[model samples]
Each structure stands twice: as structure tokens, then as C-alpha cells.
Target: MGKITGFMEYERLEEGYRPVEERVKHYKEFVVGLTDEQAKIQGARCMDCGTPFCNNGCPINNIIPDFNDLVYRQDWESAIAVLHSTNNFPEFTGRICPAPCEAACTLNVNDDPVGIKSIEHAIIDKAWAEGWVRPQPARIKTGKRVAIVGSGPAGLAAAQQLARAGHDVTVFEKNNRIGGLLRYGIPDFKMEKWLIDRRVEQMQAEGVTFRTGVMVGALPSEGPAAKVTNDAKETVSPEQLLAEFDAVLLAGGAEQSRDLPVPGRELDGIHFAMEFLPQQNKVNAGDKIKKQIRADGKHVIVIGGGDTGSDCVGTSNRHGAASVTQFEVMPMPPAQENKALTWPYWPIKLRTSSSHEEGCQREFAISTKAFIGHKGKVTGLKTVQVEFKDGKLVEIPGTEKEWKADLVLLAMGFTNPVPTVLEAFGVEKDARGNAKATTDFIGGYATNVPKVFAAGDMRRGQSLVVWAIREGRQAARAVDEFLMGFSDLPR
Candidate 1:
């Protein structure tokens, strides 16, 4: 620890956001990162605990105490080195990760935990500014080829690891851009697209090939049509990929948005959160969407109380919606969790996102029964208040009500990955439709099919970006060991 008494002297400082009025006008990152001195103070809050639970709390197992100490001692270069040793992309996680590590912080037993995420954000930004972040190309070529599908956090992490291990790595993405959800599903207001672009540039310099707008599976003949990018006019098939590469890793995300099947579900103004989110992101990236879904002057009703639903609320508010309302089937969580009983573990506490702070009415213990519409357009939503009894949700007798809703967005999270892609490759899947694979000591990430591996949301179901990165890094080690009978990569 840089200063043993630092925690007692200085209070915790957090990153600030742009004023709501000013930021709502445009889609841009508004978080004001900490200054160098402020970050040092925050880093000094890390205690010299014999057991660092923060390490286990983090999905990527970041050496939190070491980096915090380095930052406190004003050692920017070493801090970034320690950070990159575990996380391939701290910028993404710093901005979006829920910071479970802080939940496990020893100081959090009573006082606010060390501002670990902000310190990480500061260290990486400083490293970039000082030109310390550079390409690390392999010293020798191994001549092993790897084909990675999907360019999300998982695929990108795996590609970087494999490329550094002297493998010929190529990443294929169906979308026009490299980042899967990070580029589209997440609103640009949370993180700018340029961050992803810079990482892609560094990866390319490190010998990783990126092929965007190249779908590595059979194109759907019918159903909801996919939005095509200007860069490509055609799609690639699974057979073409299998024939071209020595090994394939399926990191494609869980893209299938869970739908609300109810009366008037086919209404015109109702859509999935994925359908509503991507267009705005594309528009922010300077792409012209001809028929963009807008919430301007409409009463928006977002179903589901998760991150995706909050994103819908934010996007709607940005579009100048007349009003917005969000519904959660589960009851609202407690305002505060009993830390004495739930130390070092994630607790069930009410979370209100920045989007919720922007403006919106939130309802809990409520479920939508039907979509009231007219002339094939959604007009309102009929909902009922419910209570849980004996592990069953029972609707209250007289709590059914209808509310005006010109546009309805379903953001109830994804059910599973698109089965066609996995099925086409003949990979066995779990009961939930995720690719079947065991993360064991031997043959980790190996699917039933030889030379095929799976990771990320496609294998573990929909999960956080940090978890995806961990899975990708581990899968890379598994692939390397399988190829060379041994690997030096970290587990």
C-alpha cells in the first residue's frame, strides 16, 4: 500500500457525468474521468489485506491491489502493465462493468470502497496519452490458423491472445463493424465508438485480421430481415469458413431477443429492444438509417427492468419522448442490503441507472397482459399487478389497468443464441440452446465437434462483457494447449 492511513484521510471520489440537459442533445460519452492526482488519492484507499477478495470478485481476476498501489505511487506504466496482464480491454469494463470488485472491498464493510473502476479508467487513459499503449506482435510465427466468429469482447480477447501466441488469427463479424454488442447494443452516450476503433487498430497491428460484414453462417430466407451494411453485398456460409480455417471458435453473442407473446403482439409500433437500440448506434456512427424507430412525441412503454430496458428509457428520453414508463415483473429490491450478512458477495439491492435518473416512471411486480392497438399500431398496454405466493406469481383481482403507449419496446433479455449457426456447424448444444462445453482442466471450451470451440454468451448464455472476456482468454489457452500439446498462456 502506498499510504497506510490514506483511506482515513481522503474521501472517495467518483467519475461525474455531463449535465442531463446538455448531454441529452447528442449521443456522446459524458463521463468526466478523474484527474491524475484524484486517481492517486482514490488508489491510495486500497488496504493491504492479506486476502484480496476483490481479485476473486472481478471476472477477469484483475490484480486490483497491485494496480491500485502502482497508481497511488504515480507509476502509470506499471499500472497499465498490471491491468493489461489480466484484462484485454479495461476501457470497456471501466465504463460498463458493474464493479463487483468494489462490493468485495474490505473498506466497503462500512465506508465507501476504493474507487477502483475510476482509477482503472484513469490509468488506461493516461497510458494512452503518454503513448505507452502499443502493439505487441509475436516474436515468432507458429503457423497455426484460427477462425473466430463474432468480434465482441470474447472474440476480440481470444483473437488477441491467440495472435500473441503466434497463431494466424482472423475474426469474422456479421455486422459491418467489429464490436458486436459494444458497438451496437450499447448506446454511444455510454461509450464512444472510437474507443473500439483504436483497439481494433492495435489488434490489427499485432497481426489479427478483422473481416467485418462477413456472416459465417447460412443467411435466413425468411423472418425478420437483417439490416445490411454498406460495406458488403453478400454473406458467407458455414461450410466456406470450416474449409478455410484449421480451428473455429464460435463467440457469436446471444442475439435472439426474448419476445412478449400477447394479444396485439404483431402491432406496428411494438419492437424488440435489439431492434430499437442498434439503429441509434448506427446513426451515431454516421450511418443513415432510412426507417429509424423514433420515440419522439410518443408515450413509450419499455417492458423489462434490466440494463437493456434502461437503455430503451434513455434512448427514448434522448429522442424527446412525450413520456416513458418501465415495468418489472419482480418486486423492487431493498434500498440497502445487509452488508454484515452478504459481505464479499453480490447483494440484491435496488439499482437505478443513469437512464432512470434522466426521467421515467418505474413499476415493479407488474406484468403486461396484452397490447391494446388499433389499425395494426400499438395504442396502449394492459397490465396487471401481481404478488408472489408459494413460488408462483398470482395476479391481483382488481389491479388490471390499461395505459397509453404509442410505442412498446420488449427488453426482457435474450433467451439463447441463434440456433441456426450452431446447428449448421454440427455443434452439440445444452438444453438452453447454448453450445455444450465444459470449462475443465483438460479440453476446455472444446465442443462435441473436433477442432471446434465455443465461448462467451453463445456457450454460457447471455452474460456480462467482463465474463465474456474471461471466457475468451481461457478458451484461447485451451485452444493453444490443444494445438501444441502445451501452452504458456495463463489459465
Candidate 2:
């Protein structure tokens, strides 16, 4: 520990946010990262606790104490090195991750947790500014080729690791861009796209090949999968990849968004959050979309209380929606969690995102029963108040009501990967429809099909980007071992 008593002397400092009025006018990151001195102070707050729970709390198991100590010592270079040791993209997680590590911080038991996330943001930004980030090309070539499907965080992480391990890695993306969900699913206001571009450039320099607009295997042209944004110009059969590459890794995301089967769902102006989100992302990237989903002067109703729904609220507000309201079927969590009961673990508590601060009416314990419309267009929706009784979600009598809404965005989260993609490769699926695979040490990430592996959302369902990176790194080792009978790569 750099300063043993620093935790008791220093107060926690959070990163600042741009004013709501100023930031809502455009789609760009609004967070103001900590200055060097502030970051140093935050790092000093990392106490000499016997065990660092923050490590396990972090999906990638970053060496938090070491980085915190390095930062406290003003070793910016070492801080970034420790950060990059586990996380391939701190810029992505530092910006968008929910910071579960902070929740598990020892200081959080009684006082504010160390501003670990802000410190991480500052470290990475400094690293990039100082040109500390560079491609590390392997000195020796393994001669083994690997094909990874989907260019999201998982696939990108695996590709980078495989390339660094001297294996020829090629990533296939169905979208026209290299970053699958990161390019389209996320809003630019949260993280700019240039970050992904620079990483792609670095990966290319490291001998990783990116094939964009190429769909490996096949996806359904209709139904839930079709709702996901895809701009494939070519289709590569599963057999071709299996034959051409020594190993195949399925790292695509869970693209099948959960749907509401209520009446009037087919009415105009109703769309999945994916359908509405990607269009704005494409538009932000300078692509002109036809009949883009606009919320200007319309009452927008966003269903599901999660990050995706919050993003919809922000985007709708940016489009000058007359009013934006978010709905959650589950009851609202407590404003704060009881630390004594939930220490060293993620806790359930009410979270107010920057989007909520901009403008939004939040509704909890409400479920949409049916859509109300006129002349084939949505006008409103019918909802009922619900409560959990005897472990059942039962609707309360006489609690039915109608709410005005010109547009409805369903953001209830994704169920699993598009079934067609897995089926096309003759891959078996778990009960949840994700690619069936295990995380065992002997043959982790390997699917039921020979020479085929799965990771990230495609194998584990919807999760955080950090988890995707972890799975990708581990799966890469598994694949490497399968190829060379052993792997020197870190787990």
C-alpha cells in the first residue's frame, strides 16, 4: 500500500458530468475524468486490505491493488501496463462498465468506495495521450489458423490474444463495421467510435485480419434475429471456415431481444430498442438512413428498466421527444443496498443514470397489457399494476390504466444468440438456446461439435463487456492448447 492511512484521510471523488442541458443537445461522451492529482488521491484510498475483493468483483480480475499502488506512486506507465494485463480495452469498460468492483470495495462497507473506475479512466486516457499503447506483433508464427465469428468485445479479445500468441486469426463480422454491438448497439454519447477504430488499427498491425460485412454461417432473414442490424455483403458457410481454419470460435452476441406478445404489438411506431438504437448509431457515423426512427415531438414509452432502456431515454430526449417515460415490470429496488448483507458482491439498488437526470418519468411495478392504437398506428398503451404475492406476479384488480405514447420501444434484454446462426453450424444449444459449451479447465469453451468452440454472449447469454473479454481470453488459451497440446498464454 502506497499510503496505509490514506483511506481514512481522503474522501471519495467521483468523475464529473457535463451539464444535462449542454450534453443532451448532442451525442458525445459527457464524463469529465479526474485530474492526475485527483486520480492519485483516489488510488491512495486503496487500503492494505488483506484480500482485494475488487479483483474478484471485476469480471476480468484486474490486478487492482497493484495499479492503485502504481498510480499512487505516480507511475503512469506501470498503471497502464497493469490495466492492460487483464483488460484489452480499458477505454470501453472505463466508459461503459457499471463498476461492480466499486460495489465490492472494502471501504464501501461503511463509507464511499474508492473511485476506482474514475482512476482507471484517467490512467487509460493518459496512456493513450502519451502514446504508451502500441501493437505487440508476435516474433514467431504458429502456422495455425483460427476463425472467430462476430467482431464484438469477445471475438476481438480472442483475435488479439491468438494473434499475439503467433496464430493467424481472422475475425468475421456481419455488420459493415468491425465492432459488432460496440459499433451499433452503444450510443456515441457514451463512447466515441474512434476508440474502436484505433484498436482495430492496432490489431491489424499485430497480424489479426478483420473481415467486415461477412456473415459466417447464416442468420434468419425474418423474426427476432432479423430485427438486429446486419449489413452483410457476403456469406461464408460453416464448412468453409471449419476446413480453412484449424479452429472456429463462435463469439457472436445474443441478438434475439425478448419481445412483448401483447395485443396491438404489430401496430406502427412500435419497434424493438435494437431497431431504434442502431439506426441512430449509423446516422451518427454519417450514414443517412431512410425513414429513421425519430422521437421529435412524440410521446416515447420505453419498456424495461436497464441500460438499453436508459439509452433509449437519452436518445429520445436528444431527438426532442415531447415526453419520455420508462417502465419496469419488477418493483423498484431500494435506493441503497444494505452493505452488511451484500458486501463483496453486486447489490440490488436503484440506479439513476445520466439519461434519467436529463429527463424521464420512471415507472416501476407496471406491466404493459396491450397496445392502444388508431388507424394502424400506436396511440397509447394499457398497463396494470402488479405485485409479487406468494412468489407470483399477480395483477391488482382495478389497477388498469391507459398511457399516451406515440412510439413504443421494447428494451427487455436479449434472450440468446440468433438460433439460425448456431443451427447453421450444426452446433448444439442449451435449454436457453445459447451455444452449449462448458468452462472446464480441460476442454473449456469447446462446443459439442468437433473443432468448434463458443464464448461470450453466444455461450453464456447477455452479459457485460468485461465478461466477454474474460471469456475470449480464456477461450483463446483453450483453443491454443487444443492446437499445440499446451499454451504459454495466461489464463
Superpose all Cα atoms of candidate 2 onto the true structure and report the RMSD in Å to 1 decimal.
0.7
Clashing pairs in 1: none
Off by over 4 Å in 1: 219-232
Model 1, range 109-134, lDDT digits (tens) per residue? 99988999999899888989999999
lDDT by residue (391-468, candidate 2, tens digit) is 999999999999999999999999999898899999999999999999999999999899999999999999989899
**Candidate 2 Cα errors over 4 Å, as ranges:** none
Query: For each candidate, what TM-score against the reference?
Result: 0.97, 0.99
Q: Please state the error at residue 489 of candidate 2 in Å.
A: 1.1
**Candidate that scores best on lDDT:** 2
TM-score of 1: 0.97
